[model samples]
Target: MSPRQTLTSLIVGLVLPSMAAVAAGKCERLVVTGSPDAPPYLWRDPQDPKHLMGANADLLKEAATQMGVKVELLFAGKRSQALEEVRSGRMDLLADTPLNTGELESLDFIHPPIAQNEIMVWTRVGHAQPFNSLAELSGHAGAMSEKTRVTPTFENTIKEHLTLAKQPNLTQAFQQLMLGQAEFVLAGRYAGLALTQTLGMSKDLQAQPLPVDTPGLYLALSFNSACNDPWLRGQLAKKMTELAASGRSSEAVARNLELWKAQLQQPASTPNQ
Candidate 1:
């Protein structure tokens, strides 16, 4: 080789290994999970039982795509189990986590929450009474899904003045309200709407206009994850900020609501396939 070609080849040989190492160290893929029953936010994909499909899943996937990272949103059983998986470092990310003191210790929450959820009261249609605030329901009996978590203040209020029952799921909570067993059911507005529509109970239930609590839903990374590096966290936070500003996160909810409706209309797939 000529002297000039030899010099260029030597330079290339020295730089390529360093570049490859850096690329290899970067996080290329993340394993993510979340609540398997929250429709329009997250739920198991009927067609693909191993994965989840919905608004939060879509938003997370889009954000990761923009960051040139592949994300696998999986069905990790119940919401509690999903959180545990992330907490144990078995999963890299929790897609739609709500801020709570208990979770902060085991997970690093990405800033600029991806979505805000309104916790609302649902009462049977025609049975609704004035509910301008949570205080108005103080003396009333309420039902909530067993997995639902409320603010500390709300929990105190329940302990002090409210009579609340925890049901196995939101459907049971709503059923209690419908049967007049409970005066109201506390649930996320979109989730309640999705359930009502799917169960053909839309005409029977109404959500109070006033939200009891508005909680921001965040993306959480397990501290033990190999990919839990500053670059990965910062990139995710930046993408989430952009998504929040573009209003696409809200749009994702609306879009997935329709998607959920369409999916439910299809005939049920046979089990044990």
Candidate 2:
């Protein structure tokens, strides 16, 4: 490892003891909630429908392990309800969310992002050109999931120029695109890939080379969290920074992508009688 990497490793190694002391004094465990529909990052655990599992879960479990604190990701409800639970202090942490000034009042955001993902436009294999920007799709009718969140800037830009076809999720948005109901579908790169492959439509879809939006997924600690103090925040920041520099988040995404793909490859089992 390089000198910088070595230093990071050392810092990370030393974090747990300090964190353990602080956690012992203030908090016992952390309750986290995340969006269950977002695949590759987080989704409902198949074994236990009420819990979450995926790359985000993997990462959170590792982080909690490093911090010497117990963490449980509960299915509080849908995305909106989950956010409400975190905001009201019924939950301690939220797995992933965008950094918005509006949320700062109730949440303490870690600086480095926990994960990063991109929203890209998908078109029929040969239909997509050497795409570069959203402006390239100016007059084409684009499809998107209403559940997908884009920056306000991108949203306004799309509204002004693109004929967007909104659907409930990436799978349906791509369905619309493939059937010629829409020219393109705006969806997350990894999530879209998994959904298209799961739907057995990967051969027909192509994600545009350029991204419409590239947002870093943040882990926000509720302001009401008992561990949402200076020490906890600082320690979490250090760990996050180390993870980012080490490319752990990216690796987690890639690892989960293969897992998702493997699931699609499995034969359909009989439904419960």
Candidate 3:
């Protein structure tokens, strides 16, 4: 072929593939699943129907934007449903899950924990005596979410006293506590506090630090995701490191805490306790 004809062919091949790649990128989408019940972590605001606004949601959105990906939020009915979505490849990512869920076998997690969640004992104020250890609560009624995983240390011990409440959300559990249906509820500190306030039960209940379980939460990707691109995980990991180093992560957590405190009408000093 003539030199001019060969140059024209090379230009066409490069430009066509470049345009095709641009089109393909536009079609790529990220689907995230979360439940509205996990306040301070994942919750739905009536003002924003399409958006789930919370600490975990904000962090995931920031990470996605930083990686130049488009995100779509899906509301799963429960934690179990969300996990099923990830396992079935219906959801691409699950943000803010405790490490003990045994989810690692079906998902790849970003390094560096997203947050530390403490499992605290919530009881009606002046109703039950505070206990220093789980053993002290033996034979007393306790409430726990269905299929919830506690650390092995407390799992067996608490199981003996667990009442197996069927409440769908933390707010409901708090309501149960107020009505004398449950002696105490087991939940994360941030979430339990948020629900107690939102449901107008803050004055009726209080949470004490328990010697239960605590675990690091992580952003995880479904193993069956169509885009199992290792680079995406690397990018997210890098962004998380940057956020932590810049103290942005801490600021975000503090901001969320403040919001929850205000919603609960509780004193900011309560966080220190």
Evaluated with lDDT, which candidate comes out highest?
1
Question: Candidate 2, clashing residue pairs?
Answer: none
Compose the digit string of candidate 1's lDDT tens values, residues 160-211. 8778998988878988988899999988888788778777899999998888
Clashes in each model (backbone N, CA, C under 3 Å)? 0, 0, 0
Q: Give the C-alpha miss distance for residue 148 in model 2, angstroms.
A: 1.9
Q: Candidate 3's residue-wise lDDT over 151-221, tens digit each?
A: 66566656565545646556566667777888888887766766666566778888775636776667788
The C-alpha TM-scores of every prediction are 0.87, 0.85, 0.71
Model 1 CA deviation exceeding 4 Å by range: 1-21, 267-273
Task: Tell me how far the alpha carbon of residue 176 in candidate 3 is from the true structure, in angstroms, after superposition.
Answer: 3.7
In the order shown, the candidates' Cα RMSDs to the true structure are 4.2, 9.3, 6.1
lDDT of each: 0.85, 0.80, 0.69
Question: How many angstroms is residue 32 displaced in model 3 relative to the true structure, after the best TM-score fit?
Answer: 1.5
Q: Output the better candidate (1/3) by TM-score.
A: 1
Measured by TM-score, how close is model 1 to the native structure?
A: 0.87
